[model samples]
Target: MSLRVGVIGGGQLARMMVPAAVNLGIDLRVLAEAEGSPAQLAATAVGDYRDLATVLEFAKTVDVITFDHEHVPEEILRELVSAGHSVHPGPDALRFAQDKLAMRRRLSELGVPVPDWAEVRSEDELAAFLEDHDGHAVLKTARGGYDGKGVRLIRDVGESTDWFRILDEDGRGGSLLVEELVDFRRELAQLVARRPSGETRLWPVVETVQRHGVCSEVFAPAPGTTSRLVDLAASIAVTIAESLDVTGVLAVELFETTDDRLLVNELAMRPHNSGHWSIEGSVTSQFEQHLRAVLDLPLGDTATRAPWTVMVNVLGGPSAGDLTDAYPKALADQPNVKVHNYGKEPRPGRKIGHVTATGDELDEAAFEARSVAALLGSDISIAP
Candidate 1:
């Protein structure tokens, strides 16, 4: 019998994994949130991920259980382990990804460099944190924040009074996280894969560009990066993966500060947006590597397929019509570029798809990617 892997959550990440599973002869099963989710092609069960019976029932069908996202409740995951089900990047490591304050505290204990942070429960506590950070700080909800949501830049304590009030009303009564606003030159990401047996592999660090807090572009190997910087980034990712006992793919979002210091900004324990370029750029795509890692199979080559690869997201696709409307012109315009539609309907600022271009020159690759992104209804203007 072929090995079966059950994935929780039915987003684009799981959708992307289907092709990899087919190529490797692995049976992929998905417990999608809805009937027409992006991963519906592989979806075998449609139900609520938070409902214990639904999840446990799905778990019985696969040899190992993984996730498309990290929002699954901790208690449910523990129950799976207790019942002898295999879960990659298990609950202990997942908690850090789910809660920012917990992540900061644990990273601090590991001597991982992160932004100065404090957990504040009230307006006065928030005020104190702001006062020390030159009256400006980034406030974040410990959970449920992603792609520019649940985070705010505040110059005064009153700016977060509503958040504090909301927390007060919550029976959980959680404290918000406040961190020193980082002065960074640019954002970077390191992608690594580890198996249950403890062997790990890392890809070249890449540069990420964010627009309105959503990742819009990624430049593989991060143009102009020094060898020392690349080694340093690799070391940091490997350390975190081993220390946390993380399995499957781990994406480490980083800040390359102006003074040349590298600081840990965030962590993602599965296939992430920054590594999307790997689909056509790496010898082994992150999707494929994730499957191998989670199944305890030997990893594959991570070498880049070209000298440069640029990925640009298709944000809020087609101003007035379906994505298919623009495909004719987009494909003809940049025949060399690869377009991946996530089968999602367009909405303002939503990631409907992405485009990638690989070449021997960075300028040409970036130009092709940005050109296709605009033609596909992404809001970004191609740089002249």
Candidate 2:
């Protein structure tokens, strides 16, 4: 009998996992949030993941459950477990990703290097943290924030007037997280997968380029990363997976500080955007690896197929139109490029899809990845 896997939340991530599920002969199913979500191609159920009854009904069918996004309420997840269901990266591990405050506290307790941070509930608490950090800080809501939302900069008490407004009205204390702005050299991501039996494997540490807090491109085996740094990243990822008892993939997003040190930035307990490159770049894609881990199957090799691989996101621009228009040019201009469009309509600043290229040299791979991505997003054109 084939293993049955059910994913909660139908987004691009779940959509991307379909091919992997097919290849492995696993039954893949999705619970979509709407009638025509991106993952509708694989969805068998459509409803709010937060609705306990809906989730319970869906969970009853699959042998194991995973996630596309992490917003499923903790109460619902806990209920699933108590009812004899298997949820990889189970509630305890997932809680860390669901709540920033809980994550920071646990990482600190584990002695993991992280930015100076504090949980602030009121304006005065934020004020004190900012004062200690030279009147500069990044404030974040403890939950329901991603892709640069739910985050704000506070340079002074006056700058935090809106949050202070919330505090004054609702007495929101201990609901916000404030941290000293990191002075990092660049962003890095370490992708690791763990099976329920305790075996784990890692993908090469990659350098990620972000524009206004959104990931723009990724370069595998980050150029100029020393061996020591790579080892450190590996250790950190492995330690966190073990500490949290995380099953399935865990992406440890980090900051390589200007002074040559590493600090834990964030964590994702499922297949993440950072590992998207592995689809065309490695022997085993993160999507397939995630399925294996959750089912306690042995992992596949993570070795890169090429010396270098570059992945670029196909972000939407002002011109929201059918992306197929870009396909002819993208295919003709860069035949070697691999493009995966998420069946999402174009909208400004939205992640519609991504393109990747692999070659012997990093520069050429990066150039083609970017050029193809631009062509697909209407950022660049191939004129006759």
Candidate 3:
């Protein structure tokens, strides 16, 4: 019998893993919150992830458990471990991904290159942080924030009073994470995977383009990356995975500073968007690698299959309905391009899927991916 892997949360991440699990002879089961969630096609149970009893019952059926998102409460994860379930990137390491304050504190302790940050629940505390830095800063909710939801930029701390009020109204000071706004030259992502038996590997550092806090595109081996920068990025990811005892995949999102340095921006201990190019670009895709890592299987090579690979997200547009209608046109236009639709309803600005392309030249790879992604979403022409 194949090892059964149970995934918590039913976003596109879990949906994408189905095929990879099937190929590896792993039985993938999903616990989704909704009947029509992206991973519903592979769902074995549908219930609230926050409910302890619901998750525990599902955990009993699977040999191992992993996450599609980091929103699972720490208590639920810890309870699973207490009950003897195998959870990759277990509660101890997952806490850093779940809470920005905890992440910042822990990375700081480890001397990890992270932007100077602090925890603040009130405007006065935020003002103090702003005063320490220039007059501007980025404020984020320490918990329940992603894809721009619960993030903000403020020159004056007073601008955040309403959030403070809401937090106070919630019966106590709510979680708030504040950080100095770095004058970053660009954003970079480094992906690494580790197993419980201590095997680890790193993927090439990649450049990430963000639109309104969401990832828009990814370029493998980040164009113009110096050997020094590449080494530094890889080392940081490796160190974090080892130090945190993180199992499965760990994505280190960093800021390439204007002053020529790296400051960690965030961490995601799972298959990440920046590594999406691996599906068609690398010797081993992250989904397959994640399964291997969690199962204590020998790790695969992280080498790129092509000289260059580009991935562009397909955003839902005003004209978007069902993307199936556009698939024929996109595929016919660029058969060399690889398109992955998340099987989600089209809502404006939503990330429904992505398109990837690989080639000998960076320009050609980027052009193919972008053009197909544009066709799949809005008709915005991307100039090479």
Candidate 4:
């Protein structure tokens, strides 16, 4: 019998995993809230990821369960584990991704480099944090925030009061975590995969560009960054995965401080936006590696296939028409570019797909990727 894998959340991640599952001969299924979700195209089932009954029922047919997002409730995950259902990146490891405060505290305990942070329950607490951090700080909800949502920059105590009230009134507020905003040179990401057997692999660190909290582009090896820095970031990713007992793929987002230090910024237990470049750049794409790790199979090679590669996210723009029209134009312009569309309905600011280009030179590949992305309507210029 073929090993069956059930995935929670039928987003683009799960959609991309389908090809990997096919390549590995594993039966892939997804639990989604509705029909026609990205992953539902290949999933064995479509249902609510948060509904225990749906999830449990879905789990019964799969050998192991994994996730596309961290939004699944911890209680439900624990219940699934307790019931003898194998869940990779289990609840213990997932909690850190689900709650920023929990992640910050644990990273601190592990002696990982991270910004100074504190949990705040009220404006008074926010004020104390701000005073200590130089009157400016980032405030984030402990849970459920993503892609620029649930995050605020407070310049003073008054803003903190407004934030506290606004978040509380929204009924989605959880504990708040405030941190000193670092003057970072750039953001980087380290991608790693771990198996239940304790085997692990790390990919080359990449630089990420974010616009409005959404990752817009990624450049592998992060121009001008030394091999030493890449090794350091990879080590940090492996350490966090081992410490958290995480199985499957994990992404550690980092901030390269002005003083030349790397600080942990965020964690994702599933295949992350940062690793999307691996699809065309690495011998083993993060999606494939994730499935391998979860199934306890031997991990694949993570070495880059080329000296440099670039991935650009295609965010829906204001053109308000079918973006597919640009595809033929893009392919005509750059035939070597690999484009992956999520099959999602276009909406302003939503991620619809990504384009990746690989070449011997970093700048050339980045230009190709950026040119394709610009055809999709991004204002960012491709640096030649």
Candidate 5:
């Protein structure tokens, strides 16, 4: 009998995993939030992931459960475990990814390098943090934030009045996460996969370019990373995964500081946007690796397929119509580039798809990827 893996949250991550599951012969099932979700191809059920009855019914069909995103309630996840269902990157490990404030405290306890941060409960607290950080800081809600949403740059306490109000409205009276603005030279991501048996593998750290807080492009192996920097990044990811007892893919977003230090920026306990290039760039894509790790199967080699691979996100599809409308021009403009459309309608700053190119030179690969991405009407410019 084939191994069954049920995924919660049917977004593009779940959609991308479908092809990997097919090749591996694992039965992939998704519990999508709604009809016509990106992962509709493999969606076997549709309902609220937070609903116990809905999720319990879906859990019965799969041998193991994983996630496409981290928004599922922790109580539901723990309940699944209590009922004897296997949930990879189990609730304990997932808590760090779900709540940024919790993540910082835990990472600090683990002696992980991270920016100075605090859980600020009021305007005075935020003001104090800002004053100490050169009058600038990044404020984030503890939960439900991603893709630059639920995040803000603040130099004054007044800027966070609304967030404070929202916190006040919550009966529990939560605190906001405030961090010293990192003086980073460039952003880097390290992708690693850890199986239930504790075996782990890491891909080369990659450089990511963000526009308007959304990932715009990636260059595999992070151009100009010395061997020492590469090793350090890998070490950090491995340490975190093992420390947290994380199962399945873990993406560690990092800040390469101007002082040559690497600090943890954020964590994602599932296949992440940064590793999307691996689909065509590496021998084992993150999507495939995620399934393998969660199933406790032997992981695949993570070596790069080319010397340089570039991934450019199709941030926004054509203003006039669907992504397919630009396919003719996009496909022909860069024949060698690979495009993965999320099958979504165009909207400003939405990630509808991504294009990747692998070649001997970074410049050539980036150009091909960018050219195709531009033709597809990415909101960002093609110029490097």
Candidate 6:
């Protein structure tokens, strides 16, 4: 019998999973909030994921429930689980992805390498942390922060006073975390997948470039990285998945310091932006691996298919014309480049699609990926 999988959140991640599900002969369905959502083009239901009635209805038609985002409420997830619906990366495991403070506390207890952080409940606590950490720090909301929102870099104690006041006035003062600003050499991401049976697999560590808290590009097997560093990242990813009892994919974003140490920066329980290059770079794409894991099928190979693979995100810019107009030019110039658009309406700084290119030489692949992204109106520089 073909396995049925129901995914929550109707975004590009779910859109990408469709092809993988089709290839694996799995029946894929999406729970979307509205018509024309990226995944709605193929989803089986249209409703709010937070509504228990809606979720239960969708779950009734599928053998397993998964996610494209971690925004779904834990209570709703618990309800589904109680009803005997199989949810991969279950509610217990997803809480860490939804709340940063909880995740940091748990990882610290697990002996994972993480930045020094403290939960600040008032201006006094914020001041103390800043004083101890060189008078500069990064503050973030414990929940609902992404793409640079709900995050602030405070270089002055006076500036942070207003931020603390705003949170306190809104009764959300307790949902905040402050951490020292570490000067890191670069950002890295380790992607791994776990099966319900406890089997696990890992992909090569990739370098991620972020612009204003949003991912701009990714490089597989991060250039000039040593085998030792790769092993370190893979070990951390595997250990976290096993410790969390995660049943699907998990991405551990890391910070590589000048001292060659790795520090966990963030956790994502589903296919992440950092893993987008795997669609064409790895022997088995992350989307495919996620489907296999959720369905309790045997996992696939995680080897890289080329020496270098690059993925460039296409952020919407101020272009009046339809973005598709650039496709003809991009394909004519670089036929080998693979483009995946999320079918979203263009908005300033929004992620619309991405382009991937692979080659024996890193420079060539990076050039191809950037060229296509530029044609789509992204303003990022491609490194040679």
The whole-model lDDT of each prediction reads 0.93, 0.89, 0.90, 0.88, 0.95, 0.89
Clashes of each: 0, 2, 0, 0, 0, 0
lDDT of residue 295 for candidate 5 = 97
TM-score list, all predictions: 0.98, 0.96, 0.97, 0.96, 0.99, 0.97
Sort by lDDT, best first: what order?
A: 5, 1, 3, 6, 2, 4
What is the per-residue lDDT of model 5 for residues 168-230, given as tens digits with 9 covering 90 to 100?
988697999999999999999999999999899999999999888989999998999999899
Regions of candidate 2 where Cα sits further than 4 Å from its true position: 167-173, 317-320, 378-384
| Comparing 4 and 5 on TM-score, the stronger one | 5
Higher-scoring candidate on TM-score, 1 or 6: 1
Q: Write the per-residue lDDT of candidate 4 for residues 1-384, one digit (tens) a residue.
A: 998888998899999999999998988888876888888876778777778998999999999999999999999999999999999989999999999999999999999999989988888888888889889999888888888887888897786676678668878655589989989999999999999999999998999998878898999868898877878898899889999999999999999999999999889999999999999899999999999999999999999999998999988732766667777787888999998888777777789888999999987888898888888765443443
Clashes of 3: 0
With candidate 1 superimposed using the best TM-score fit, by how many Å does residue 54's alpha carbon deviate from the native? 0.3
**Which portions of model 3 miss their true places by more than 4 Å?**
317-320, 379-384
Q: Write the per-residue lDDT of candidate 1 for residues 225-316, one digit (tens) a residue.
A: 99988999999999999998899999999999999989998999999999999999999999999999999999999999999999999999
* Weakest 10 consecutive residues of candidate 5 by summed lDDT: 375-384
Point out where model 1 deviates above 4 Å. 381-384
Best by lDDT: 5
Candidate 2 vs candidate 5: which has greater lDDT?
Answer: 5
Show where candidate 6 strays beyond 4 Å: 161-163, 169-173, 381-384
For 233-327, candidate 6 gives per-residue lDDT tens digits of: 99999989999888889999999998899999999999999999999999999999999998888999999999999999988842776568777
